[model samples]
Target: MNESKFFWQACRLLWMSGILLVLISWGSDVPVSTAVSNISYATTITVDSSRDVSTSLSERCDTHTPCTLRRAIVQARLLAPAARPVLIQFDIPTSDVGYDASQELWELEVKSTTDPAVFRTVEGGQVTIDGTTQPHGRVDGPKIILVGPATGNKNGLIIGVNASGSHDNNIVRGLGFQNFKDHLTINSSHNTIEDNWFGLTSEGQQPYLRNDNPQDGSGSAGVVLISGAEQNLVQQNTFLAFDGVAIALRGNDNTVRHNQIGTNALGLLTLKQTSPSLLCTPEDWLGGGGISADGTGHLIEENIIAGLRQQIFAISTQPDAIWVQSTCTSCTIQNNQVGVDAEGHEVGVCGRGFYLTNTKQVQVIDNVLAETYHSALFLNGALYDANTLRGNIIRKSTPWLIPDDSPKGDDAILRFTGLPDPLEFFNPAKITHIEGTTVSGTAGDGSPCPNCVIELFLDDNDNINEALESVAVVTAKADGTWSATLPTPLADGFGLRTSSTTAQFNTIANISAGTTVGLSELYMPGYVGYLPLITR
Candidate 1:
């Protein structure tokens, strides 16, 4: 058959199949026949529901006006996965305002309602659930997108991997989620989950609400990617204030980069059901937390973990801000920080920095750890052949101090040669400029960290941990005012981070945008703590 005849035959076949299709030329603006089976199209579904099916909306809902999130997802799945497939956009009219004061956000609260009523499932392979269409990203405005069940046992959003993507190729971006047990269960690969707030506020800075229950349920996890979730990018999202771990990565070969990880009982967790019996939350959580990477060949780089202090017996317990355990052999954790208050006062506990248990050949490089009860990094009985640990900075109180007095060394790095190898050069570089630097700042709550040390670092291309040295270190006064007069060096940029010893909160600020020689009052605005200058 000639090309013209083939085209007409294709068109006739698609029309007979009765599938709604729109075909456009791949290279030009010429109109193509989507009625042909060779042509695939795109569908856009708009949601306007503030309530889940359990409340007021219809489940198994159509892809028409007054749509719900569940309906949009379900309708999108109807069209067989295609190259240019469906898009689920939002025009959600929310009743509640968000952290910002000028924006009106969209909210989806799921509760006591699942299946039958609305056939609650968001099934898709080539679908994009974009929440950016609404108002978002303002300190006191409304959340542009919010999805969570208010009162029921509804699991948030369960997504299956795409048919043809390298790793989570599906897109779940620019949205806010809360309340439901687990926010997202991404079974896809090669997808991008960027600019979203999971278990956090619309601004991705503070926790929308703190759901801390050590009792009834497993609490909630922001995102849970099961096995086979390879090469996916989970970045720039806020995993904060959940009852359980923030991110649980059961997959392998993934990259989690440049995200603001907030305080929860457990921040990030990675594990396998197979080998050496990993110790997670139920095991007293002393093994590791904040960011747990226990998968093979994973990269967790340049992330900030703040306000993640777990309470024990009414006092804050020392937990690993980053846990590298299980059989996560050959994983790299670099330039991550704990005990960071974004260059401000202490609001977070800044618990134990890094914990490495039963693992081999894990590399931990260029991290800043401060204000911990026990030690910065801990290693257990599992170091055999070759492992590299270096370029880490640590500041902490004596283990024999009032609250943390456990007779443990208040040392910078706690090594179990059976595990950790903090080489002499990689040992904690003094964050304290005891003689020559002036540092002053208040807490996130407008107070000062009493008797805390201030450290100033030279910012080399924005990396202040291993790339820069401590230019100044000073102790804070009773009123939180701290200063040290030292000769200033001319450098490209500078990083200043401060934390209190007695107080659990922390913050950071950078002098990169300051005068050559002037007072830089850092500001970290949030509840727990931040590193506007951990500057990470």
Candidate 2:
């Protein structure tokens, strides 16, 4: 391939790797060398202090002279164009005053201005602010904490603006950002934000509570990518406890994968601040949520979102684990676990799994959504075309199920106001029988559109589809008949259910009513003495 082709391919591969795997750790930083190989010049700037003070432009970030984060950022921006890129590492002492009285925490306090305190604009791209170089950066969570001021709106960092697209390929990794209006705002492209903790404490155990005035300084969000910011990769990060959205995407073609939005790093515990009196007032969280996408062509996959719910006094509006607005066209949200933990168990409180309103050409596939108090899949607003929901396991949580205030029938999927054809979007699939390994289903009992795919799942002792594992997948014939035999026979007394996905529109129907498997349903084989006989 040509050099340009090779470069683009390498970048694509790098993005895929970032989306699929944890790209960085405390021992190593994001591959600045490998990512920008074409760049001839580079420099390293080491920050030794956790202070937010600026340094002279002429000074170098080396030993003998103290280098602050603010100074390193400014110097990197100035040197970035000529140097091509700059690596900013940390070397702050654990005993510095920046550390708490217990000496277990280290933070840099940036006073909030009219807008948030932007450490630097990151003029030239390819700048890496890696906190993994700090003393306890090797720990499971972040070590360097960037704390906002007591009052006023504070923003942790901003990268580039729309006017100038020079800021690209910048990276912010292994840091803890708390109490910022929008922790990190990006307007540039090709940037990677990985392995960071937002709205959480340095240890990543719980939400950061502002001690100065508990009711004040609640941040609007953790990360906000402006409209101009496209093709950015936000992966392997933890977002929780923000007053509003955790990650708000207004850009196109960004990929948010493997991120823990509302869950801990292990994807087990919820990091939401439950107490209304201690933090901001109860009114702050009305309709607040996990992830909101208003951009087009974005890929949101492999995220664990729970935590969101109706806060105190917020009766009418409920939060969603993931919200896709009308502007987000041609987006794909797949393999995500909403209202459920990494182990597929219902863990946290979520109002809805997905709230898609007026979205166009969006695809929701292969996601597990459970334990939501409201509808698991809610589609409303203007008429949208070519939107699809296929193979998603959405069900109410059994045993630990939250009571649904507004019941939209027994099914957890809800559709209203300008939906597609009923068979394609509103109708539920039907399970005729589940005999032995073979399972049969109907798409609305042989509707006009009969060609579809059916998926069978072992229900969790109820009519609702709770289990994440699908037992069988079968293709429905043009006559609306579908059957699939599993590898092993299903046990008697077990409840089985199926869902349908239209071949034409690719829309999935609500899960069918649970049918109990019977003992007589097992396929019997004839045997002669000790020899087994196979019969059709």
Candidate 3:
């Protein structure tokens, strides 16, 4: 009985050993299938006549199937290699699949391979990349080219090129992207989007409907919805009739140069709100103000901004033209021409030139302002203490109306009323030399206030009271005239005194109960000085 039991135990152990061997062999063979699935051969599946065909990449290379354009893309992607670039060309236009304005014709999905950056997808579609359709997965590579008639149905292109890394050296060129409710989002950095046309014609409703929740329209944008991207460039593109904005930039250290942005509800709004949690707030919405910038260390130069309806208007009741809310510590806005209104009427308009708010250490120089309705440069609700405005030519800004006064073109310079006490009565009209260095002439309406006190204090320290002893107070005679000889040397170093100043003459008599006040001339040297009077 003991011998029989031992023999049965030995047989049981042998059966267990054979099962372990089978499991090991199966594990080793499974990788072979995985490797085969990842590697694909070069194959072309054409659809000359209309038919839907389903075939694997291996079978496609052996037998060319006549398939629809959408299915052919799936087959091509399935058989692509990790390192090699694949070129899929749709030569024929077939209507057998039916016209789907929602979905694009060839929707290819490039899955997350072993190394996505090494693989590229090149598509030349005869039809459009409609908004309702979903394209393939994220493709990683140095280059992604989509050429042909590609329209954003109401939605735009979802190019998820950068998942990791600081830079995405991707190139998207030669495609027509239009009518997208939302922006064609480019999440990657260091990319180039060039030679594209984006705009909208619909006025009744919003431009695009969102995918997750279809109730709201995506809000039209020209090209590239920039979020968290830096050091990227958008150039040489034409934008028209978008509801929200042409191009909105959220990231910093980026450059938007040499682009023609015009005739939309708004144009090129830039926001610098970097908080990820607060990205979708209403403050980020683009109404107008071509190319708004909120972040720091950004350069907005050399772009033509024309026909901007309200180039600078607030989303809420707040007023500003180019609203710079973020702390852009050191930025430069130079060599740009703003406010040549093609429509020729400026009402409810902001930033005819610029509206700066809560920003410091900015330099605005060498810009031309032509035919603007508001102030050529408006600084409101903020301190422009350390900022510099030099060499800017502001011409033809007339009929300045700011919800308060109806000042004509003669009241050209506009400044905030009620400043500090020492500079309190500082009129912008007094400082601005409109007729070039002659303050003794008649005012805008030819009526001269001859007794108007014009004080001009010089830079040098000179005692006019001690110099002219007997005639200390030099009072002007009639005919609105006053003249004073220099008690000290009238050379470069000496300046005029404030106390012993003279008054000018008056032409119109002040009618106080039908009585006339005598005319007098008041002259203060520093108050009526010309261009070379003050030195920086």
lDDT for 1 in candidate 1 is 10
Q: Is candidate 1 or candidate 2 better by TM-score?
A: 2
Per-residue lDDT tens digits for candidate 1, residues 356-387, read 77665676766766555445666555332234
Ranking by TM-score: 2, 1, 3
Expressed as tens digits, the lDDT of each residue in 99-213 for candidate 3 is 2223323222222223212122222211122111113211111011221122333344433434243225334443344334543556666555654444422221122222322
Model 2 stretches astray by more than 4 angstroms: 1-41, 54-65, 100-105, 135-138, 210-218, 270-288, 310-312, 342-345, 398-410, 417-429, 460-468, 505-536
Q: Model 1 segments beyond 4 Å from truth?
A: 1-41, 53-65, 93-103, 114-124, 135-142, 145-147, 150-153, 161-168, 201-218, 263-289, 311-318, 344-350, 383-385, 397-410, 417-536
Off by over 4 Å in 3: 1-154, 161-167, 200-219, 224-227, 264-289, 310-321, 341-351, 382-385, 404-536
Among the numbered candidates, top TM-score falls to: 2
| TM-score of every prediction relative to native | 0.59, 0.77, 0.45
lDDT winner among the candidates? 2
Query: Residue 266, candidate 2: how far off, in angstroms?
Result: 4.2
* lDDT at position 444, candidate 2: 55
State in Å the error of residue 420, model 1.
10
